[model samples]
Target: MINGDFNGDGNLDIVVANEDDGYLAILLGNGNGTFTGPFYSAPIFSYQISIYAADFNADNVLDLAIASSDTYTLVISLGSGNGNFEDPTFLSPENYYSANFAIGNFDTDTIL
Candidate 1:
């Protein structure tokens, strides 16, 4: 998990992706400073990707970026205020997949 907070709220969220399952899960940031995930399961028909966490939408709530060998996709889930996240997949750009991904606001728009 990138920016792993370990409690999953909305202020310290983390981003994690798997390639074989093509699954990208976000760990929400709890205001108290912790991240929680396991929000989704690995799909049966896909490759796992490397994921990174950041607030791509600049919503203050953390967003996720899943990196594939072909591209990097964004999944910004809405926070339930309880460390739970739901669908909000936003495709970003073509990025090469690596065993690990870097997290941060490389564009100075969010956090890692």
Candidate 2:
């Protein structure tokens, strides 16, 4: 699971990878110790393991990077800044050691 202010609402929201179901579920925070949702992403048909949240497109909105072990793939879900995400964009890593990754401005060039 991962948590952040996904909707720019200043409240912490959550994202969970459903390993058994091959999808990601989001829970939007209400800021009063409560949350709502379980908003789902499209199925990946693989065993999901790790998830990373960041603004991958430099859009200032938090986005998602989901890793699946069973299929050896990584998927991107761009956020709409309103607790909603676009469809997943699938990627195949040639020699990934595990179903996990880190997000950062690896090149130190103001982008990720």
Candidate number of the best lDDT: 2
TM-score of each: 0.45, 0.89
What ranges in model 1 sit over 4 Å off?
6-15, 24-37, 41-45, 70-81, 88-112
Estimate, for each residue in 1-112, the C-alpha lDDT of model 1 and write its tens digit: 4664434432555555555456555556556655445576333124434555455555565444454444444344443334444555554554633434566557764444
Name the Cα RMSD for model 1.
5.8
After superposition, candidate 2 runs with Cα above 4 Å error: 94-98
- Please give the CA lDDT of all the candidate structures: 0.49, 0.85
Distance from true location, Cα of 16 in model 1, Å: 3.7
Estimate, for each residue in 1-112, the C-alpha lDDT of model 2 and write its tens digit: 9999888999999988888888778899999999998888777656887888889999999998888778778889899999888988877665564487888888999999
Which residue pairs show collisions in model 2? none
